[model samples]
Target: MADPVAITAPTTVLIKVIHCIVGIMTAPLPHPTGLAYHRMGHCTGRHRWWRPLLGTLLFLGAYLVLSLVLFALSYGVGAAAGLRELPDGGHDFGPLANTALDLTSIAIALPLILLAVWWPGRRPPGTLSSVDGRLRWRWLARCLLAAVLPVAVLAVTAALLPDSGSDSGEFGAWVGWRSFLTSLAVLAVLVPVQAAAEEYVFRGWLTQAVGAFVRSPWFAVLPQAPLFAAAHGWGTTWGFLGLLVFGVVAGWLTIRTGGLEAAVALHVLNNLLGFGVAAAVVDGLSSDETAADSPWQLALADVATTLLYAALVLWLARRHQPRRLASPVASSPAPAPAPATTGRTVGHHGESGQDR
Candidate 1:
């Protein structure tokens, strides 16, 4: 017989390897007190200086490659289906098809952001969602309710007030109920995903990416704002300024309330309202005028309304007291030098069931 000791040695090695892999998979996330939304990335134990940087490269590559593929596929399909390319409709697609394509393109970032956190970043992805580890759905629902009324009021008020500077679309003949309802249904489903992805990219990932290096939330929040504005494409001066201000406000709210809930609530509602308006009228969706195309009056009112909405959210936050800072997971205080934080950590497999 082969020597028993030799046989046992190989088996022992296999066991040790299995154990090490398991340990990494289940390793607890750092639990740090006073971990703000921006600083959540720095709270993980696995954080090396290079992880976030590498992850960013991966993110850009993956997103660009996939997005190109998606658009090419969409273009091919649209052509097959007799969809009109602009100036008739979406770029190489029908209006509705192109709008769905755009919304879906933005939506993909949400998953990619989570993946970056899990692999190269080597932490629980939940930390990026909020201080509480996962998205606070209850809090998000409440915020959604809070935003609806003000946004509705403002949208109606703007419509009633005559269009200034001539860019806001004319209230043309109502598209038949079929066109309006179909567009509404599509917007309702995809708009929230699109909005949430943007929030995750700007408010969630960008802020925390910077916060991983800098402790200050303002420093973390400020950088993403301009990028957010630029992403919308420069239009009039007022419109660009409006986007910048909106970005700043959204970023601030993400930090102030300890999660993306408030920002997402605002974004989803705002997009739905805006898109709904475009859908309601003749060929309105065909016009590519975004929030970035707002004239001065609309831009100023948009900013003011955002601030007012922020104020209302702040009042609600005070009353509800959503957890803003990371709390330690271990019985003893988490080590000061730990790399990452939140109610949970990024796992290779799935999220910690505890925090959710």
Candidate 2:
């Protein structure tokens, strides 16, 4: 797994470009290849010596290239159809995409995971090693601490805040129960894939790579936190914070527990529950008779929710003070003793002097 063999800069760039093109054209959604490549690029010192700076640059380039390609495709289709102007109403297409992205990620991610799992080695790194296989009780507690506390804090804050000028209003109604059920089924099927991708990136890949370089827990845990956060983009500050903090906690737990299973379990459960809550809230509050309006307000609420959620997650992590898992000590080698020296007797001027 350690690809220490030097990859020439030109080769890396060429591979990256090919990867971006293949990944984009093949998948309906952008492949997580960009993410995987970036992470590998950083770990391998291909990306500006441990900084993901070049990796980020590569990702952005890939993203831009992919976006342009998609735009061209759409434009071509639109032109052939004789459509001069785009639709005025939005077609957010969440339900439509639900199946493709989920299925694609799983279909792509699983084979790679299996390959990594089956590969023979002196020791499998991350939580995959036999010694680290045992699950810990405290991880479940941390999962609970992560999922519940943040939502509770956000709910309270939303309750207290005056319904200001905002736009939770334009939020559309849920798809039919059937559509929702289908989405749920797709999610259930894909949760493992999504969770595995995250765990592989954060706990499996980055944590081990970071652990190899840094002796201290902070150094190992700190770097991946922001990466996790930034991956969420400006989705919501609080949510971003929550995931980043959760990333740190999970990384620490993996370092301690020696397995990514617990982290994956917690992540899937958290996401499923969060999605369920949001769906339920949307359905329960909105009706044809009482439809609301406000875009800016919803945006504000999102920001607030992300911030509040992040704060709560960090607070919980602080309260728990989970340390890195205990690693077994290795046997020490004994020190070698100093070698003995014998001096040959020096000959004197005469035989009598030598005898005396």
Candidate 3:
């Protein structure tokens, strides 16, 4: 058996590197904002077109570098394990390994995003999490709770649909008590981080940066949706559409609640349930054959599920009011003028002025 230490050693090193980068990038820059990005123009005090452009480039660079490192580490682990390659020259690490790889890559984005917003834009790290410069844990808990029912319903719906591809056997062969348990453990630990990191990047960092530049909330919401969809490389028309809708709705929730908590909750629930079900029933979350149905029924079911989740979250938001969106630049009181030294003293209540 391959030593677990061998796999973990590289990961530890990568994590240390990530931490060092985050520390340096997040070290207190000026022009802090507690509000969302659309209202952050005054904080940075720079409206140059290049600011957003450069900021985007910086974020991409950080993400790409970190992702490459993670990929190399994962590849090294796979090579050591003697994992076999698919016919297409891709290694099949099964569901557990794949989930770990996906989540680790996603998890790395959180600090990078904080760096992107802080270093170049001169915003505080809290601004990336919420409009109030703080993450509302209570509200996030509520949203996560509200997301459960809708996601469960979607899961049931997907299960009821017939499997249309031969890859059903693929899941069965790869999935067993041992592998399932391992995948479950990985998902339990990393899925939340993965979901939250994505929300912070798309709905939080990228949206706000664009919002800050255009000074419009819609500008923040719309452009990021396609980019989010593209990130998935869903490989089918319906899959692309489904992800696009998800992105749009998530962005909307961010704007509506003045924070990323609601969107994060919805995403966490959706991924947790989706991946959990695949791991349990299909024995794998991905397959060589596109497991989608011919008429796009399953795809539509996924879309419906996402929409239902969105509706439930929105309803909850309305019932228990979250913080309204505010300007990122908080107003500070101006200092009062100093009293003159060699001047006549002013008397109160119509008294005569006395010379000092």
- The most accurate candidate by lDDT is 1
The per-residue C-alpha lDDT of model 2 at residue 338 equals: 26
Better of 1 and 3 by TM-score: 1
The best-first sequence of candidates by TM-score reads 1, 3, 2
For the record, the alpha-carbon RMSD of candidate 1 to the native fold, in angstroms, is 8.3
Could you estimate the TM-score for every candidate?
0.83, 0.47, 0.76
What's model 2's lDDT at 279?
44
At residue 96, give the lDDT of candidate 3. 67
lDDT of each: 0.84, 0.46, 0.72
Top TM-score hit: 1
RMSD of 3: 10.3
Model 2, total clashes: 12
Instruction: List, residue by residue over 112-231, the lDDT tens digit for candidate 3.
Output: 877766677665667677666668899899988888887787778877877645434536544567767877888988999998888888888778777775666788799889988887
Per-residue lDDT of model 2, residues 114-233, tens digit only:
233222211222223212222344654565456565445544654566655333444455556775676567666666566666676666645545654455656767787788766555
The better candidate by lDDT, 1 or 2, is 1
Cα displacement (angstroms), candidate 2, residue 350, comes to 65
Worst 10 residues of 3 by lDDT: 287-296
| Model 3 lDDT at residue 22 | 72
Which tens-of-lDDT digit does each residue in 15-98 have in candidate 1?
999987666545555654558899887667666878878988999999999998887787677778876675533355556766
